[model samples]
Target: MTTEKLVSEIRKKHSFLCVGLDVDLDKIPSFLLNEEDPIFSFNKAIIDATHQFAVAYKPNTAFYEAYGIQGWKSLEKTIKYLNENYPEVFTIADAKRGDIGNTSSRYAKAFFEDLGFDSVTVAPYMGKDSVEPFLNFKDKHTILLALTSNEGAFDFQTKKVEDDEVYKHVLKTSKNWKNSENLMYVIGATKAEYLAEVRNIVPKSFLLVPGVGAQGGSLTEVCKYGMAENIGLLINSSRGIIYASQEANFAEVAAKQAEKMQLEMKTILDGIH
Candidate 1:
């Protein structure tokens, strides 16, 4: 989807919530395990229940990759279902695949053309050549991992390089890349404190923020420093919402969790207006 359309959907829904589909078979209800495609079944239920409250859905690649070919089929079916039934909802392939130029081009095509995801998460460690290929696609997005929400991020992202921080350098350098206007960033909610610094570098760029709920990141702090005129944030929640319950009423429980976040988002958007 176009960035304008994405912003429009957020306005219409009063939300910028992106529900993460980090489905693990062990975590889902035991009953679902009996289904022919338990993963897809669980995803469908959650998507149906929470679609109204969320503007996006991100399926982390590792969860499906663990199950091998069968898992991949489930992931394919999930995306196909969303494309057919709810095209308005943005889809993200949370596949942090980045490599050399040629390899990166294939990775970009696989997600953008083959899988039909609106965006793909890309690691920027390989520098601009590895990431620019993904940005070349029209109407597609390359969400570069910046200050991620993980303990290890401190190892490099926060380390000072020259006069500025490493992640700050990443943010500034990204603007010089090809087709960077289509670029979004992954700024972990755990790194919410650095948002003001990030904003000075790319004020209007959208940020795919993970680390809410389960990671104990403050939603209010994220918006306070990260929000742009377009409400440029896609706050993500995974197990906290999808696996809220492991029983037959899992979908209903997931919906309740999503509604809670959406209500908070509504209040934030109201303040913006």
Candidate 2:
């Protein structure tokens, strides 16, 4: 999806909510386990329930990968369902895959072409060559991991690499890559204070922010510091929304949670729109 399309969706819905489909069998309702593809079953319901309030759906690949071959099938079906049913809503394969240049090319093709995700998350630790391949895909986004929500992020991301933090250099150096325009970033809402510096570097790029709901990140603080003029923030809430209920009406309950966030986002967007 083009950046313009994503922005347009956000404006139309008065929301920039990206519901993270981080499904866990251990946590999902017991009854769903009887279904042939429980993962896809759960995802389809969530997408149906939350599409009105969400502009994007992100399925963290780990959730599917854990189920092995069946898991892979579930992921494929889930993406297909989203593309066919909710074409307007953005899809993200939160795969976090990055490797050598050639390997990265295959990864790009797998997610962008075969599976048809609008975007995929990539780790930038291997540097420019590893990431440029994904950037080569026009309109498909490469969301590079920046300041993350985990405590271990302090171990590397915030450390001084000479005069600046490592993530600052990641943001700065990445701008000169091949199709840098395709780059978006993953900034953790838990580290909202660092967003000011992040914006200073990539003022106009979209940020896929996690840690807002389940992880206790402040949505208000993230918007205050990181929001672009176009409202370039996809605030993700995984467990807080999808796992809101474990009963027969799970999807209905999930919709309510998503709408709650959407209403909050609507109020924020109202200020500038």
Candidate 3:
């Protein structure tokens, strides 16, 4: 989906929420295991229940990859279901893949052409050559890791490189890459304070922010500094929403959790206008 269309969906739904389909079999209700494909079954239920309240759905690749071939099948089914049923909802493959130019191109093709994801998460440690391949795919976004929502982020992201923080350098330098307009970024909600400085570097790029509910990040603080005129933030909630309840009524409970965030987002959008 185009950035404009994504923004349009955010406005139409009064939400920038991106539900994370980071399904772990151990965490999901055991009843789903009886189904032919437990992972896909669980994802379908959650997507159906929460799609209305969310503008995007991100399925972290690790969850599926851990299960091997069956996991890959489940992931394929999940994305196919979304594309067929809810084409308006943006899909992100949280793969965090980066490699040599030739290798990165294959990875890009796997997610963008074969898997049909609207965007894919990528690591930037390998520099422009590794990421430029992914950016070349028209209409597909390459969301580079900038400031993450993990305890280890301080190990390098916040460390000063000359005068500016390392992540700030990543944000500034990425703009010069090929097809950079298609680039988005991952900025953890936990580091909301750094958002103002982040925005000053790339005022228009979209940010896929994780670490909200489960991680105790402040949604209000994130928006206060990170929100752009277009509301360029896709706040994700995984465990907090999908695992709201592991009972038979899991989908219903997930919907309720999503609705709560959607309502808050609507209020924020209202104030923006």
Candidate 4:
């Protein structure tokens, strides 16, 4: 989707919520295990329940990859369902993929062309050549990893490098590449303090933030520091929402959780809109 279209949807819905489908087989309701495709069944219900509350759906590729080919098929079906049913809702493959130019091009095609995701998360460790390929796709986005939520992020992202933090450089350098206007950043909600700097570097670019509900990140702090004029934030909640209950009413509970977040987003957007 184009950046303008995405921002329009957020404004129309008064929300920038991105529900993460990080489905774990072990955690899902056991009754679903009997279904032909339990993972897809779970996802279908969650999407149906929460679609009105969210502007995006992000499926972490690892969750499906671990289940082998069958898992991958479930992912395909899940994304296809969203694209066909809710074309305005953005879709992201949280794959965190980046490699050499040629490899990145193929990865781009895989997610945007083959799978039909509106965007994909990419590791910026490999630098411009790796990320630019994904940005080249028309109307598709390349969400580069910046300040992450994990504890291990301190191992490198926060380290000073020539008078600047490493992630700071990653964000700044990434904008210089071709079609960088289509680029976005993954700034973990846990690192809300650094968002001011990240924002200064890419003021208009969207940010896909994780670690809100389950990881204890402050949504208020993230919005206060990270929000742009367009409300460029897609706060994600996986376990907290999707796994709100393990019973047959799982999807209902998940929808309620998502509704809570969407209401918060609406209030935030109200001030600026």
TM of each candidate vs. truth: 0.99, 0.99, 0.99, 0.98
Better model by TM-score, 1 or 4? Answer: 1
Model 3 accuracy (lDDT, Cα): 0.96
Q: CA lDDT of each candidate? A: 0.95, 0.94, 0.96, 0.92
Q: By TM-score, how accurate is candidate 4? A: 0.98
1-273 per-residue lDDT for model 3 (tens digits): 899999999999999999999999999999999999999999999999999999999999999999999999999999999999999999999999999999999999999999999999999999999999999988999999999999999999999998888999999899999899999999999978899999999998999999998898999999999999989999999998999999999999999999999999999989989
Following a full C-alpha superposition, what root-mean-square deviation does model 2 have from the true structure?
0.7
Q: For candidate 4, lDDT tens digit of each residue in 71-160?
A: 999999999999999999999999999999999999999999999999999999988898889989899998999989999999999999
Which 10 residues in a row give candidate 2 its minimum summed lDDT? 264-273
Clashes of 4: 0
- Give a tens-digit lDDT track for model 2, residues 48-100: 98999999999999988898999999999999999999999999999999999
Position 9, candidate 1: lDDT: 99
Say which prediction, candidate 3 or candidate 4, comes out ahead on TM-score. 3
Best by lDDT: 3
